[model samples]
Target: MNYWLVKSEPFKYSWDDFVNQGVGTWDGVRNYQARNNLTAMKLDDLVLFYHSNEGMEVVGIAKVVKEAYPDPTIEDPRWVVVDLTAVEKLPKAVTLKSIKSDERLQDVSLIRQSRLSVQQLKKEEFDVIISKAYEN
Candidate 1:
């Protein structure tokens, strides 16, 4: 399954909010690249939920429950969204600082394209981040 990372501001939509809601419609993507990433998601693909802006950390895991569909929050035909259900919260959130410090994660999109709201991750990259989350 493909792995991905999606960002949300904690104040607007935190990990707790996602778990409480059960399933979340990952929408509001306007950027073409980010929109494409959303379109690429398939059913059961794993996703890392990151808290951008204030926290700047990967907080939880989610999986795609539904594939791309016209974003319900908007009337625009060009945009789409995927349904995601929270899988698990990380034992320890992986901070941007820690990721940047790790040699293995230097090439991750989170570092190269910090402003991108959604990103694709290689399996190795995804695994490294997951390992970091479980580290002491």
Candidate 2:
């Protein structure tokens, strides 16, 4: 299964909100690269639920419940979205600052292309981050 990371501000849609909701459609992605990433998503794919702007950390895990579809929240046809189901909350959030400072994570898209709201994660990077989440 492919691994991905998607970002949202905590105020707008926190990890708690996602878990409480159980499953929800992920939308409002405007960038072309981000849109492409959404389109590539498939059912059962794992996603990192990231809180951008404020804390800038990955707070939980989610699984894609549905593949890409035309975003319902917008009138424009350019954007797409996917349904995501909350999997589990990270014991400790992996901050973007911490990720960027780690040598092992140097090649992660989160640091290489910080502007991309949605991006693919390398398998090694995925394993590393998830392991970090469970760390003390």
- What Cα-based lDDT does every candidate model obtain? 0.96, 0.91
lDDT of candidate 1? 0.96
Candidate 2: where is the Cα deviation over 4 Å?
none
Best by TM-score: 1
Please give, for residues 1-136, the per-residue lDDT of candidate 1 as tens digits: 9999999999999999999999999989999999999999999999999999989999999999999999999999999999999999999999999999999999999999999999999999999999999998
Error of 1 at 36 (Å): 0.3
Model 2 agreement with the true structure over 69-116: per-residue lDDT tens digits: 999999988989899999899999999988887889999889989888
List runs of model 1 lying over 4 Å from the truth.
Answer: none
Residue-level lDDT for 79 in candidate 1: 99
Instruction: Please give the lDDT score at residue 71 for candidate 2.
Output: 98
Question: Considering only N, C-alpha and C atoms within 3 Å, which residue pairs clash in candidate 1?
Answer: none
Any residue pairs clashing in model 2, and if so which? none
Candidate 2 steric clashes: 0
Compute each candidate's TM-score over C-alphas.
Answer: 0.98, 0.95
